[model samples]
Target: GAGVSQSPSNKVTEKGKDVELRCDPISGHTALYWYRQSLGQGLEFLIYFQGNSAPDKSGLPSDRFSAERTGGSVSTLTIQRTQQEDSAVYLCASSPQPGTGNYEQYFGPGTRLTVT
Candidate 1:
Protein backbone atom coordinates (compact mmCIF):
# COMPACT_ATOMS: atom_id res chain seq x y z
CA GLY A 1 0.00 0.00 0.00
CA ALA A 2 1.32 3.39 -0.98
CA GLY A 3 -0.01 5.06 2.12
CA VAL A 4 1.09 6.07 5.56
CA SER A 5 3.13 3.56 7.58
CA GLN A 6 4.12 3.33 11.22
CA SER A 7 6.88 1.37 12.93
CA PRO A 8 7.24 -0.66 16.14
CA SER A 9 3.60 -1.71 15.88
CA ASN A 10 3.65 -2.54 19.55
CA LYS A 11 5.73 -1.23 22.42
CA VAL A 12 5.73 -1.96 26.13
CA THR A 13 7.69 0.28 28.42
CA GLU A 14 7.97 1.01 32.11
CA LYS A 15 6.88 4.28 33.66
CA GLY A 16 9.33 7.17 33.25
CA LYS A 17 10.88 5.58 30.15
CA ASP A 18 11.24 7.45 26.89
CA VAL A 19 9.83 6.11 23.63
CA GLU A 20 9.98 7.12 20.01
CA LEU A 21 7.45 6.23 17.30
CA ARG A 22 7.99 6.56 13.58
CA CYS A 23 5.75 7.37 10.64
CA ASP A 24 6.37 7.42 6.91
CA PRO A 25 3.82 9.18 4.76
CA ILE A 26 3.01 8.70 1.14
CA SER A 27 5.38 10.32 -1.29
CA GLY A 28 4.61 13.96 -2.04
CA HIS A 29 2.10 14.38 0.71
CA THR A 30 2.48 17.82 2.19
CA ALA A 31 0.22 17.52 5.20
CA LEU A 32 0.96 15.07 8.01
CA TYR A 33 -0.78 14.57 11.32
CA TRP A 34 -0.37 12.58 14.50
CA TYR A 35 -3.12 11.37 16.80
CA ARG A 36 -3.66 9.28 19.89
CA GLN A 37 -6.49 6.85 20.57
CA SER A 38 -7.27 5.38 23.92
CA LEU A 39 -9.32 2.22 24.33
CA GLY A 40 -12.89 2.87 23.16
CA GLN A 41 -12.11 6.52 22.60
CA GLY A 42 -11.98 8.68 19.51
CA LEU A 43 -8.74 9.81 17.99
CA GLU A 44 -7.28 12.90 19.60
CA PHE A 45 -5.23 15.16 17.38
CA LEU A 46 -1.63 15.50 18.54
CA ILE A 47 0.19 17.51 15.92
CA TYR A 48 0.04 18.63 12.31
CA PHE A 49 2.67 19.51 9.71
CA GLN A 50 2.11 21.15 6.37
CA GLY A 51 4.90 21.73 3.96
CA ASN A 52 7.49 24.08 5.46
CA SER A 53 4.93 25.69 7.73
CA ALA A 54 5.42 25.72 11.47
CA PRO A 55 3.95 22.52 12.86
CA ASP A 56 0.78 22.82 14.90
CA LYS A 57 1.52 21.18 18.21
CA SER A 58 -1.33 22.59 20.27
CA GLY A 59 -2.95 19.17 20.51
CA LEU A 60 -0.07 17.65 22.40
CA PRO A 61 -1.29 16.65 25.84
CA SER A 62 1.82 17.81 27.64
CA ASP A 63 5.37 18.95 27.19
CA ARG A 64 6.35 15.29 27.35
CA PHE A 65 4.79 14.59 23.96
CA SER A 66 6.41 16.04 20.84
CA ALA A 67 6.85 15.28 17.16
CA GLU A 68 8.70 16.44 14.09
CA ARG A 69 8.56 15.79 10.37
CA THR A 70 11.85 15.63 8.55
CA GLY A 71 12.28 16.50 4.86
CA GLY A 72 8.47 16.67 4.74
CA SER A 73 8.21 12.91 4.40
CA VAL A 74 9.05 11.03 7.58
CA SER A 75 7.84 11.89 11.05
CA THR A 76 8.77 10.86 14.57
CA LEU A 77 6.74 11.19 17.75
CA THR A 78 8.53 11.15 21.07
CA ILE A 79 7.17 10.65 24.55
CA GLN A 80 9.42 11.50 27.45
CA ARG A 81 8.90 9.95 30.87
CA THR A 82 6.14 7.66 29.78
CA GLN A 83 3.18 7.40 32.10
CA GLN A 84 0.51 4.75 32.55
CA GLU A 85 -2.05 7.23 31.30
CA ASP A 86 -0.06 7.55 28.11
CA SER A 87 -0.86 4.00 27.05
CA ALA A 88 -2.66 4.28 23.76
CA VAL A 89 -2.49 3.67 20.05
CA TYR A 90 -0.60 6.35 18.13
CA LEU A 91 -1.97 7.01 14.65
CA CYS A 92 -0.46 8.90 11.75
CA ALA A 93 -2.24 10.34 8.73
CA SER A 94 -1.37 12.38 5.68
CA SER A 95 -3.09 14.40 3.01
CA PRO A 96 -1.92 15.92 -0.21
CA GLN A 97 -3.52 19.20 0.66
CA PRO A 98 -5.46 20.81 3.45
CA GLY A 99 -9.18 21.63 3.29
CA THR A 100 -9.50 21.07 -0.41
CA GLY A 101 -12.97 20.06 -1.57
CA ASN A 102 -11.72 16.51 -2.12
CA TYR A 103 -9.23 16.53 0.71
CA GLU A 104 -9.11 13.46 2.90
CA GLN A 105 -6.62 11.86 5.18
CA TYR A 106 -5.15 8.38 4.83
CA PHE A 107 -4.37 6.74 8.13
CA GLY A 108 -1.70 4.27 9.13
CA PRO A 109 -2.51 1.15 11.09
CA GLY A 110 -0.96 2.81 14.14
CA THR A 111 1.59 1.95 16.84
CA ARG A 112 0.33 0.66 20.15
CA LEU A 113 2.26 1.90 23.18
CA THR A 114 1.67 0.50 26.63
CA VAL A 115 3.19 1.87 29.78
CA THR A 116 3.44 -0.33 32.83
Candidate 2:
Protein backbone atom coordinates (compact mmCIF):
# COMPACT_ATOMS: atom_id res chain seq x y z
CA GLY A 1 0.00 0.00 0.00
CA ALA A 2 2.66 2.44 -0.92
CA GLY A 3 1.26 5.96 -1.26
CA VAL A 4 3.22 7.49 -4.15
CA SER A 5 6.84 8.12 -4.81
CA GLN A 6 8.75 10.36 -7.26
CA SER A 7 12.47 10.21 -7.94
CA PRO A 8 15.36 12.67 -7.62
CA SER A 9 13.18 14.88 -5.36
CA ASN A 10 15.16 17.58 -7.13
CA LYS A 11 16.82 18.00 -10.50
CA VAL A 12 19.02 20.60 -12.12
CA THR A 13 19.80 20.77 -15.82
CA GLU A 14 21.04 23.11 -18.49
CA LYS A 15 18.76 24.70 -21.00
CA GLY A 16 17.89 22.47 -23.95
CA LYS A 17 18.59 19.30 -22.01
CA ASP A 18 16.07 16.55 -21.49
CA VAL A 19 14.80 14.89 -18.33
CA GLU A 20 12.68 11.95 -17.37
CA LEU A 21 10.75 11.90 -14.09
CA ARG A 22 9.38 8.72 -12.59
CA CYS A 23 6.30 8.09 -10.51
CA ASP A 24 5.21 5.03 -8.54
CA PRO A 25 1.61 5.13 -7.46
CA ILE A 26 -0.18 3.15 -4.82
CA SER A 27 -0.88 -0.46 -5.63
CA GLY A 28 -4.27 -1.06 -7.26
CA HIS A 29 -4.77 2.60 -8.09
CA THR A 30 -6.48 2.84 -11.46
CA ALA A 31 -6.01 6.53 -12.10
CA LEU A 32 -2.79 8.48 -12.33
CA TYR A 33 -2.26 12.18 -12.93
CA TRP A 34 0.62 14.52 -13.56
CA TYR A 35 0.59 18.18 -12.64
CA ARG A 36 3.02 21.05 -12.48
CA GLN A 37 3.22 23.81 -9.88
CA SER A 38 5.12 26.93 -10.78
CA LEU A 39 5.27 30.60 -9.89
CA GLY A 40 3.17 31.81 -12.79
CA GLN A 41 1.04 28.71 -13.14
CA GLY A 42 -0.49 27.76 -9.82
CA LEU A 43 -1.28 24.15 -10.59
CA GLU A 44 -1.52 22.88 -14.15
CA PHE A 45 -2.84 19.46 -14.94
CA LEU A 46 -0.43 17.79 -17.34
CA ILE A 47 -1.66 14.33 -18.23
CA TYR A 48 -3.70 11.41 -16.90
CA PHE A 49 -4.02 7.69 -17.42
CA GLN A 50 -6.72 5.46 -16.11
CA GLY A 51 -7.13 1.71 -16.21
CA ASN A 52 -6.76 0.39 -19.78
CA SER A 53 -7.79 3.58 -21.50
CA ALA A 54 -5.87 6.03 -23.65
CA PRO A 55 -4.09 8.67 -21.66
CA ASP A 56 -5.44 12.20 -21.64
CA LYS A 57 -2.58 14.43 -22.75
CA SER A 58 -4.61 17.58 -23.14
CA GLY A 59 -2.74 19.42 -20.44
CA LEU A 60 0.76 18.77 -21.66
CA PRO A 61 2.54 22.05 -22.13
CA SER A 62 4.21 21.21 -25.43
CA ASP A 63 5.06 18.44 -27.81
CA ARG A 64 8.32 18.03 -25.93
CA PHE A 65 6.44 16.64 -22.94
CA SER A 66 5.02 13.14 -23.11
CA ALA A 67 4.08 10.31 -20.77
CA GLU A 68 3.39 6.62 -20.90
CA ARG A 69 1.70 4.17 -18.58
CA THR A 70 3.12 0.70 -18.78
CA GLY A 71 1.31 -2.48 -17.73
CA GLY A 72 -1.41 -0.32 -16.18
CA SER A 73 0.84 0.19 -13.21
CA VAL A 74 3.89 2.37 -13.63
CA SER A 75 4.11 5.66 -15.50
CA THR A 76 6.96 7.83 -16.67
CA LEU A 77 6.92 11.45 -17.77
CA THR A 78 9.56 12.60 -20.19
CA ILE A 79 10.39 16.18 -20.92
CA GLN A 80 12.49 16.85 -23.98
CA ARG A 81 14.61 19.93 -24.51
CA THR A 82 14.06 21.51 -21.13
CA GLN A 83 13.91 25.27 -20.77
CA GLN A 84 14.21 27.78 -17.97
CA GLU A 85 10.51 28.34 -18.11
CA ASP A 86 10.03 24.64 -17.47
CA SER A 87 11.62 24.80 -14.04
CA ALA A 88 8.95 23.87 -11.56
CA VAL A 89 7.60 21.14 -9.30
CA TYR A 90 6.48 18.09 -11.23
CA LEU A 91 3.88 16.28 -9.16
CA CYS A 92 2.18 12.91 -9.57
CA ALA A 93 -1.06 11.74 -8.07
CA SER A 94 -3.31 8.66 -8.11
CA SER A 95 -6.89 7.82 -7.33
CA PRO A 96 -9.81 5.53 -8.11
CA GLN A 97 -11.58 7.96 -10.42
CA PRO A 98 -10.59 8.59 -14.00
CA GLY A 99 -12.61 11.65 -15.02
CA THR A 100 -14.60 12.57 -11.95
CA GLY A 101 -14.26 14.26 -8.59
CA ASN A 102 -11.99 17.00 -7.31
CA TYR A 103 -10.65 14.48 -4.79
CA GLU A 104 -9.27 12.20 -7.45
CA GLN A 105 -5.64 12.89 -6.62
CA TYR A 106 -3.02 12.19 -3.99
CA PHE A 107 0.15 14.19 -4.68
CA GLY A 108 3.80 13.30 -4.46
CA PRO A 109 6.43 15.57 -2.98
CA GLY A 110 7.30 16.47 -6.57
CA THR A 111 10.52 16.70 -8.52
CA ARG A 112 11.89 20.18 -8.29
CA LEU A 113 13.65 21.02 -11.56
CA THR A 114 15.90 24.00 -12.03
CA VAL A 115 17.01 25.01 -15.49
CA THR A 116 19.77 27.46 -16.20
Candidate 3:
Protein backbone atom coordinates (compact mmCIF):
# COMPACT_ATOMS: atom_id res chain seq x y z
CA GLY A 1 0.00 0.00 0.00
CA ALA A 2 2.98 2.30 0.35
CA GLY A 3 3.82 4.59 -2.53
CA VAL A 4 7.22 5.77 -3.73
CA SER A 5 9.23 7.70 -1.20
CA GLN A 6 12.37 9.84 -1.40
CA SER A 7 14.46 11.30 1.36
CA PRO A 8 15.33 14.94 2.08
CA SER A 9 12.93 16.74 -0.19
CA ASN A 10 15.62 19.41 -0.26
CA LYS A 11 19.35 19.03 0.15
CA VAL A 12 22.15 21.59 0.21
CA THR A 13 25.84 20.78 0.08
CA GLU A 14 29.15 22.36 -0.85
CA LYS A 15 30.90 21.71 -4.09
CA GLY A 16 33.12 18.62 -4.09
CA LYS A 17 31.18 16.99 -1.29
CA ASP A 18 29.40 13.71 -1.69
CA VAL A 19 25.66 13.26 -1.32
CA GLU A 20 23.33 10.32 -1.37
CA LEU A 21 19.65 10.45 -2.26
CA ARG A 22 17.26 7.62 -1.62
CA CYS A 23 14.05 6.34 -3.15
CA ASP A 24 11.54 3.65 -2.14
CA PRO A 25 9.18 2.43 -4.78
CA ILE A 26 5.71 1.08 -4.35
CA SER A 27 4.87 -2.49 -3.49
CA GLY A 28 4.42 -4.96 -6.34
CA HIS A 29 6.00 -2.68 -8.91
CA THR A 30 8.82 -4.42 -10.71
CA ALA A 31 10.37 -1.50 -12.55
CA LEU A 32 12.15 1.56 -11.18
CA TYR A 33 13.73 4.52 -12.91
CA TRP A 34 15.66 7.61 -11.94
CA TYR A 35 15.59 10.87 -13.77
CA ARG A 36 16.85 14.41 -13.29
CA GLN A 37 15.87 17.89 -14.36
CA SER A 38 18.22 20.82 -14.18
CA LEU A 39 17.14 24.37 -13.52
CA GLY A 40 14.68 25.31 -16.17
CA GLN A 41 15.72 22.20 -18.05
CA GLY A 42 13.89 19.14 -19.18
CA LEU A 43 13.97 15.69 -17.61
CA GLU A 44 16.98 13.51 -18.31
CA PHE A 45 17.11 9.81 -17.69
CA LEU A 46 19.72 8.69 -15.19
CA ILE A 47 19.26 5.01 -14.45
CA TYR A 48 16.55 2.36 -14.68
CA PHE A 49 15.98 -1.19 -13.50
CA GLN A 50 13.40 -3.90 -13.88
CA GLY A 51 13.33 -7.10 -11.85
CA ASN A 52 16.70 -8.94 -12.13
CA SER A 53 17.74 -7.34 -15.39
CA ALA A 54 20.75 -5.07 -15.75
CA PRO A 55 20.30 -1.40 -14.99
CA ASP A 56 20.73 1.29 -17.61
CA LYS A 57 22.89 4.17 -16.42
CA SER A 58 23.71 5.88 -19.66
CA GLY A 59 22.26 9.22 -18.58
CA LEU A 60 24.59 9.75 -15.66
CA PRO A 61 26.18 13.13 -16.19
CA SER A 62 29.70 12.04 -15.29
CA ASP A 63 31.71 9.40 -13.53
CA ARG A 64 30.96 11.14 -10.26
CA PHE A 65 27.32 10.11 -10.43
CA SER A 66 26.17 6.60 -9.71
CA ALA A 67 23.15 4.68 -8.41
CA GLU A 68 21.86 1.28 -7.37
CA ARG A 69 18.51 -0.39 -6.78
CA THR A 70 18.36 -3.20 -4.25
CA GLY A 71 15.69 -5.89 -3.72
CA GLY A 72 14.08 -4.51 -6.82
CA SER A 73 12.67 -1.82 -4.59
CA VAL A 74 14.84 0.71 -2.80
CA SER A 75 17.23 2.81 -4.86
CA THR A 76 19.98 5.23 -4.03
CA LEU A 77 21.69 7.86 -6.12
CA THR A 78 25.12 8.89 -4.99
CA ILE A 79 27.01 11.93 -6.08
CA GLN A 80 30.72 11.46 -5.49
CA ARG A 81 31.52 15.15 -5.76
CA THR A 82 28.85 17.74 -5.82
CA GLN A 83 29.03 20.65 -8.21
CA GLN A 84 27.00 23.74 -9.01
CA GLU A 85 26.13 22.05 -12.25
CA ASP A 86 24.89 19.07 -10.29
CA SER A 87 22.22 21.11 -8.56
CA ALA A 88 18.89 19.86 -9.75
CA VAL A 89 15.80 17.91 -8.84
CA TYR A 90 16.44 14.18 -8.82
CA LEU A 91 13.27 12.23 -9.52
CA CYS A 92 12.40 8.55 -9.26
CA ALA A 93 9.59 6.68 -10.88
CA SER A 94 8.16 3.19 -10.80
CA SER A 95 5.80 1.18 -12.92
CA PRO A 96 4.43 -2.29 -13.41
CA GLN A 97 7.02 -3.01 -16.09
CA PRO A 98 9.89 -0.57 -16.29
CA GLY A 99 12.02 -2.53 -18.68
CA THR A 100 9.02 -3.09 -20.86
CA GLY A 101 7.34 -0.58 -23.12
CA ASN A 102 4.03 1.37 -22.95
CA TYR A 103 3.41 1.50 -19.19
CA GLU A 104 3.23 4.89 -17.49
CA GLN A 105 5.46 5.53 -14.52
CA TYR A 106 4.48 6.74 -11.05
CA PHE A 107 6.81 9.51 -9.90
CA GLY A 108 8.01 10.61 -6.53
CA PRO A 109 8.05 14.22 -5.43
CA GLY A 110 11.82 14.30 -6.02
CA THR A 111 14.90 15.39 -4.11
CA ARG A 112 16.03 18.91 -4.76
CA LEU A 113 19.82 19.19 -4.48
CA THR A 114 21.64 22.48 -4.29
CA VAL A 115 25.40 22.89 -4.43
CA THR A 116 27.33 25.99 -3.59
Candidate 4:
Protein backbone atom coordinates (compact mmCIF):
# COMPACT_ATOMS: atom_id res chain seq x y z
CA GLY A 1 0.00 0.00 0.00
CA ALA A 2 2.93 2.28 -0.35
CA GLY A 3 2.85 5.28 -2.67
CA VAL A 4 5.46 6.56 -5.08
CA SER A 5 8.64 7.39 -3.19
CA GLN A 6 12.06 8.85 -4.04
CA SER A 7 15.34 8.53 -2.18
CA PRO A 8 17.91 10.97 -0.82
CA SER A 9 15.37 13.79 -0.44
CA ASN A 10 18.34 16.08 -1.00
CA LYS A 11 21.52 15.43 -2.92
CA VAL A 12 24.60 17.62 -3.17
CA THR A 13 27.33 16.89 -5.72
CA GLU A 14 30.07 18.66 -7.59
CA LYS A 15 30.03 19.29 -11.31
CA GLY A 16 31.17 16.32 -13.38
CA LYS A 17 30.05 13.83 -10.73
CA ASP A 18 27.50 11.17 -11.47
CA VAL A 19 24.34 10.62 -9.42
CA GLU A 20 21.67 7.97 -9.46
CA LEU A 21 18.26 8.79 -8.09
CA ARG A 22 15.89 6.00 -7.11
CA CYS A 23 12.12 5.70 -7.24
CA ASP A 24 9.70 3.05 -6.01
CA PRO A 25 6.27 3.14 -7.54
CA ILE A 26 3.09 1.72 -6.13
CA SER A 27 2.51 -1.97 -6.50
CA GLY A 28 0.63 -3.10 -9.64
CA HIS A 29 0.83 0.28 -11.31
CA THR A 30 1.41 -0.14 -15.02
CA ALA A 31 2.80 3.30 -15.73
CA LEU A 32 5.75 5.23 -14.34
CA TYR A 33 7.10 8.65 -15.19
CA TRP A 34 10.07 10.88 -14.40
CA TYR A 35 10.00 14.67 -14.40
CA ARG A 36 12.21 17.59 -13.54
CA GLN A 37 11.32 20.97 -12.05
CA SER A 38 13.83 23.76 -12.37
CA LEU A 39 13.90 26.81 -10.17
CA GLY A 40 10.63 28.73 -10.62
CA GLN A 41 9.71 26.55 -13.56
CA GLY A 42 6.90 24.11 -14.14
CA LEU A 43 7.37 20.34 -14.14
CA GLU A 44 9.16 19.22 -17.27
CA PHE A 45 8.32 15.79 -18.63
CA LEU A 46 11.15 13.29 -18.78
CA ILE A 47 11.01 9.56 -19.42
CA TYR A 48 7.90 7.40 -19.30
CA PHE A 49 7.31 3.66 -19.06
CA GLN A 50 4.12 1.74 -19.47
CA GLY A 51 3.86 -1.94 -18.82
CA ASN A 52 6.20 -3.72 -21.28
CA SER A 53 5.99 -1.11 -24.00
CA ALA A 54 9.01 0.86 -25.14
CA PRO A 55 9.63 3.87 -22.96
CA ASP A 56 9.12 7.36 -24.32
CA LYS A 57 12.44 9.06 -23.63
CA SER A 58 11.98 12.11 -25.81
CA GLY A 59 11.93 14.33 -22.77
CA LEU A 60 15.45 13.58 -21.64
CA PRO A 61 17.51 16.73 -22.01
CA SER A 62 20.59 15.00 -23.34
CA ASP A 63 22.57 11.78 -23.43
CA ARG A 64 23.78 12.45 -19.91
CA PHE A 65 20.36 11.55 -18.51
CA SER A 66 19.00 8.03 -18.50
CA ALA A 67 16.55 5.88 -16.54
CA GLU A 68 15.41 2.32 -16.19
CA ARG A 69 12.44 0.51 -14.69
CA THR A 70 13.20 -2.99 -13.54
CA GLY A 71 10.44 -5.64 -13.15
CA GLY A 72 7.91 -2.85 -13.72
CA SER A 73 8.19 -1.70 -10.15
CA VAL A 74 11.32 0.18 -9.24
CA SER A 75 13.03 2.84 -11.36
CA THR A 76 16.33 4.64 -11.29
CA LEU A 77 17.39 7.83 -13.04
CA THR A 78 21.08 8.27 -13.69
CA ILE A 79 22.63 11.62 -14.45
CA GLN A 80 26.15 11.38 -15.78
CA ARG A 81 28.64 14.21 -15.45
CA THR A 82 26.28 16.35 -13.46
CA GLN A 83 26.06 19.99 -14.43
CA GLN A 84 24.87 23.13 -12.65
CA GLU A 85 21.89 23.21 -14.98
CA ASP A 86 20.89 19.82 -13.62
CA SER A 87 20.24 21.23 -10.19
CA ALA A 88 16.54 20.84 -9.50
CA VAL A 89 13.92 18.59 -7.97
CA TYR A 90 13.52 15.26 -9.68
CA LEU A 91 9.98 13.90 -9.42
CA CYS A 92 8.53 10.45 -10.01
CA ALA A 93 4.92 9.56 -10.63
CA SER A 94 2.83 6.46 -11.26
CA SER A 95 -0.59 5.83 -12.63
CA PRO A 96 -2.94 2.91 -12.91
CA GLN A 97 -3.27 3.37 -16.65
CA PRO A 98 -1.23 4.78 -19.55
CA GLY A 99 -1.51 7.56 -22.13
CA THR A 100 -2.31 11.27 -21.87
CA GLY A 101 -6.04 10.92 -21.38
CA ASN A 102 -7.56 11.67 -18.00
CA TYR A 103 -5.71 9.23 -15.77
CA GLU A 104 -4.44 10.50 -12.46
CA GLN A 105 -0.90 10.04 -11.27
CA TYR A 106 0.48 9.77 -7.77
CA PHE A 107 3.65 11.80 -7.25
CA GLY A 108 6.60 11.41 -4.91
CA PRO A 109 8.03 14.13 -2.74
CA GLY A 110 10.88 14.43 -5.23
CA THR A 111 14.67 14.39 -4.86
CA ARG A 112 16.28 17.79 -4.75
CA LEU A 113 19.66 17.64 -6.48
CA THR A 114 22.18 20.43 -6.05
CA VAL A 115 25.28 20.71 -8.20
CA THR A 116 27.86 22.78 -6.45
Best by lDDT: 4
Clashes of each: 0, 0, 0, 0
Q: Report lDDT (Cα) of residue 53, candidate 4.
A: 92
Worst 10 residues of 1 by lDDT: 95-104
Estimate candidate 1's alpha-carbon lDDT, on a 0 to 1 scale. 0.95
Model 3, 1-116: lDDT tens digits are: 77789998999999999999999998889989999999899999999888898988888889999988888889999999788999999999989864457698889999999999
Q: List the residue pairs that clash in candidate 1.
A: none
Those runs of model 4 whose alpha carbons end farther than 4 Å from true positions after fitting are 99-102
lDDT against the true structure, each candidate: 0.95, 0.89, 0.90, 0.96
Please give each candidate's TM-score.
0.96, 0.91, 0.93, 0.95
Sliding window of 10 residues with minimal summed lDDT for model 3: 96-105
Mark the regions of model 3 whose C-alpha exceeds 4 Å error after superposition: 98-102
RMSD of candidate 3 to true structure, Å = 1.6
Tell me how far candidate 4 lies from the true structure as C-alpha RMSD in angstroms.
1.7
Ranking by lDDT: 4, 1, 3, 2
Better of 2 and 4 by TM-score: 4
